[model samples]
Target chain A: MAEKVIAGFTVNVTEEGYLTDKTQWNKEIAAEIAQELGIEELTNAHWNVIDFLQKDYAETGKLPTIRRMKKEGGISTKDLYDLFPEGPLVKAAKIAGLSKPASCV
Target chain B: MKKLLILGAGTAGTMMANHLNKKLDLKEWSITIVDQEPQHYYQPGFLFIPFEIYSERDVVKEKKQFFPKSVEYIQAPIKLIEAEQNLVILQDNTRINYDLLIIATGCKIAPDEIDGLEDGWRKNIFDFYTFDGSVALRNKLREWEGGKMVLHLAEMPIKCPVAPLEFLFLADWFFNVKGIRKNVEITYVTPLSGAFTKPRASAVLGNLFETKNINIVPNFNVSHVEAEDNKLISLDGKEVEYDLLVTIPTNMGDQLIERSGLGDELNFVPTDKHTLQSKAYENIFVIGDATDIPASKAGSVAHFEAEILTENILSYIHGKPLEAHFDGHANCYIESGYNKAFLIDFNYDVEPVEGTFPLPGVGPFSLLKETTINHWGKMAFRHIYWYMLLKGIPIPTVPPHMKTSGKKL
Candidate 1:
């Protein structure tokens, strides 16, 4: 674990930059993380996914997979990819201030 | 007399039935096992079928042959599990009440879940996850002239998560032996960020994949398959063309779980990861691929779960605390082709590391490294699975909980 400054606040994160403590997250922090990951702006579509990921993780103690995000998060696969390019679930979880989705090793 | 019911006579259910048979008092309890299928499949052998290493005969066995004499076996498809009422209704509306229930109804591939996949299924695209699928694929591979072969995994939480990797490794060897290795270009497509999920194992296996000349396309969440175009379309509109497509479709739990309203998004029962008890019902327990426990859905995991589950079930019966806990221990043999295999041992928190198994620094199987001895261990497991594993016989020196003593950490 390492400490990184996001939105003028130092937060604990993994080597890959995923937040170690999800509770130390805010909308401002999300924007900063997203910006660092190459997204210049955080849109409502991105917020919807981030909100769903945080709420789902809080309730289930597990990050939702891309399939779960599509089934339960009311987002289509294409839209998810459109919102977070490359790896949707991985990127979305990172921006959402959640640990990386286990996806079952 | 008290009634204890076991559902689905697959590997997990059969082992539980056998474990409880000797442990439970026959005079005080009556054990009944139910399953629709008459033949119990050695599912691990399915991995060998496509490569023609094992036939249908080797994997097939009579379900009744393993059951103890005291346990009554019922052959009927279950309609629904009335968890609230502690009743299970069969397809014919046969109602059976139980004091305890063990849900071991394992998962199956739903190829129909993906759009346009059915149109090419068994024609150009094939799956080796099932008996019929493996047999059909074997037939197709028998005469395949060799072209671009793509092995795609539809989603995660699949049964034996390593099977897809094993399939590709074996295919590499199979084609090499058939002298078509030069002609067939193999590509592995996965939804994960890498070849395997765990970092250490992924690095090791990913290197092996490169050494075998297999291409890997990671983070490819498939949106649909375009059978007409002979192309796989990812959610991001990325496409991969293939001459022959072998895919592991989305695996979901038995529909009976869904009908009973006892499952999660994928119809897997919500189970206590450590205790093997159903979170929804006190009288109910879940094991194997049917449980949403975040463990790899493999027979080896089930074998480990059975040991802990047997003790927990007994504790539940006696109204005591569930002491035994499953550590998500999973031991798997990865067939890497050319009569060599890799053995992996890990639990909930541990990833597979290089070490010796059963004995530390002794003359035997090596872990996280490809070796002929590990391949022989995998071959020998067929006998152990049949003669000992299902019969509730403890495998000597191999405990249910993963031991960290020999592990390098």
Candidate 2:
């Protein structure tokens, strides 16, 4: 893990830029990370998804998959793609201050 | 006598029954297994059926033949699992109480989950994930002239995660042998970002795809199948047209899981990844494709899980700690066609890397690289699965856990 400054706050991050310690995240950090990942601005719709992801991860201790996000988060796949662009789950999870969703390898 | 009940007489349940039968004292514990089907299918052979590599006779056997005489087998559909009361009710309304339960009801392909898919199913679209589907696809391939052949995966966490890749690889070799390789256009479409789940394996297999003239369309999360237009439309509006579509549909656990109110959104029981125990109930355990573990849903995974689960069950029964843990161990053989295949060994922590298996440096079977010997090893596994694995007998050299020796880090 390496320390990086995001939104004027230093935090630990993985090599892929995901927050290592989710507790260090805040709204400013999420918006900054989102902007860095090419999401121009965080809309209310975007925040809804981020909230769902963060809440689900905090409760389960595991990042929800794209399927779970669609089914439980009450978001359509089309909307997720529209909100986060390419690779929606990875980008949303990163912005939500969670590790990348683990794919069954 | 205390009762030990096993649901679903498939690979995992059957293995557990055989295991507990020998381990549990007959004077103290009685074992009973339940399933709807009488035939035990060798699921890995389903991949070979489309290529005509194995016939129906080769992959099928009576489920009763594999079970130990001490264990009672009930051929009936499960209606519901009353977890709170430790009672399982059958379709005939027969209720059985158990001191402990093991759920091994595996998953199956659900084509109806996708819009417009059922319209073309068994017509322009086909699947080989089931016995009848494989046989149907074989008949379809036997007479069909070559055209655009698209192999698609509707979603992730399907049983035998590498089967679709293997199917494409074998299809390339199949068409070539049929002298129609030039006439057929082959493509692989998946929601994943690459050819395989692991980065290293994906790179290796991606290079092979290039060599074999196969095309790949990644990150294409399919929204629906347009049967009339012969197109697969993504949620983002991207489209892929095909002459023949071979798809791995959305795989979900048994409907009984839903009926019993014991599953998640996908109907897979919430399970503890390490202990193989049900997260909600202490006496109820889960194994194989039935659980929502992050491991690949394959028979090899179930085999590895059976070993750890047996020890854990015994520990639980004896009022000891559930110390034995499953590391999500999965060993699979990918048939790349033409008597060549690749072997992979991994778990929840380690991704499959280039290594020698079983004997470490002295391996007769190589891992992560294509070899002719691996092909033979895969072929030989059918016999081993029948004679040893399902019977709860350990292989001579292979262990249940992943070994890090002789691996290229």
Candidate 3:
């Protein structure tokens, strides 16, 4: 197991730096992690994506795919890409305090 | 009596041996096949290894298992092909003369071409092209949590051009299965401007990349790998950082082809795209990854080429003009994760369009659209490759020619 201190909170991670424990995540932690990842501020629009990803993942134990987000999360394709420059699912899932979603890419 | 020699006992060579053995008279013609590897690897199965969908045992078999008993097998690495003298020189200094030759020595992944790739290979950077590489990568992925996972293609004309995208898809599935999906950032970097080489398929696959949240770094002509810094630098001074990198390196034809001075700049035999015959040598035929044809470097293309080459070879032996022409036909299964896959069938003239395959509007398989049946077909092809294809038995209804009966424009 690996560990990282993000926003002054110690979290267990995988060797590749994925959060091993999802329960340690919170909005403040997400904000700090987002800031570390180079996102200056978390807008409501970003939170809308993050909150939906978090709740959906908790409920289903799966990260909703980009298609699923577009269908159910009510976010347009353009907005989703805008929220996360190169990795929308990656960044959104991180801010939502969850691990990555499995295959389709 | 005449001797027909085949180089390499891979997909193309093995199939050619079976096809010719049945067609030629044993009393009149003797056939010999040479290859370095003792085992026949089902190349497509390499994709399933890292995902744990396949094991090494599933992909490997004794090369002799497929060769007909009458055909002589020489287990030796080729040193050179003395094309001028119609002879092949083996590494052991033995020579074999032939009246007709078929070059099927397939392409190989050349990692050393990119600076710093050899230093990080199998440590942080890995490829699935080799059996050992796939097994090593599988072990790595088993323990890896995920962070900035990048799947890259060093250049085009690699075997199964769609495979890199498939790996990205399967990685998504693999991480999700491990419950670390949020931790992995999947990105696809390619030399091509789009997701695939073909336009329509590129658009569809590109959309899938976006929908799957797999980032695309297009037009990335990789100049080198900075393993210590965890960056891939392109020729134009761009850099992409990665925690784990899975790449298909620059693919080149057999070195023996280069040593013999029989190949082009990349060591690929210059082949007549329509005839499957070597442009430089009249009596020599080229198949599969060995040929510098515009067709996709795929098993299906080799199978299709073998059919035409079979007829052409028979004509050449009889002192008749070769009438058969290859259409650069290719078909492949694109696994989109989950239980669905897409099937595409095309020729030199046609691109993969949406429709049913092998039938007009009544296919058991769908083309250019994802379906569970296509996934089953893709899985089922392993059996077909071993039993029907390598045996030279023509698959019913799946003709060598690309038909437009079921395709939608």
lDDT of 2 by residue, B1-409 (tens): 9999999999999999988888888899999999999999999999999899999999999999988998999999999999999999999999999999999999999898899999898998999999999999999999989999999998877999888889999999999999999999999998876675555666566588889999999878888999999999987888999999999999999999999999987889999999999999999999999998888899999999999999999999999999998998899998998899999898877888888988889888998999999999999999999999999999988889999997886
As a whole number from 0 to 100, the lDDT of residue B401 in candidate 1 is 88
User: Which digits, one per residue and each the tens of the lDDT, describe model 1 over residues B9-89?
Assistant: 999999999999999988999999999999989999999998889988999999999999999999999999998899999
Interface RMSD of 3: 16.1
What's the lDDT for residue B344 in model 1? 92
The model with the greater DockQ, 1 or 3, is: 1
Query: In model 1 chain B, which range of ten residues has the least summed lDDT?
Result: B197-206
Residue-level lDDT tens digits of model 2 in A1-105:
589999999999976688878789999999999999999899999999999998886655566667788888898877899998877877888899987654443
Query: What lDDT does model 3 reach?
Result: 0.84
Position B263, candidate 1: lDDT: 89
Backbone clashes in model 3:
11
Give the per-residue Cα lDDT of candidate 2 at B251: 93
Query: What is the Å distance of residue B122 in model 2 from its true position?
Result: 0.5
What lDDT does candidate 3 reach at residue B170?
Answer: 82
Can you rank all candidates by lDDT, best first? 1, 2, 3
Report lDDT (Cα) of residue B129, candidate 1: 87
Query: Which residue ranges in model 3 land beyond 4 Å of their true spot?
Result: A1-105
Give me the runs in candidate 2 sitting further than 4 Å from their true place.
A1-29, A58-63, A97-105
Order the candidate numbers by DockQ, best to worst: 1, 2, 3
Clash number for each model:
0, 0, 11
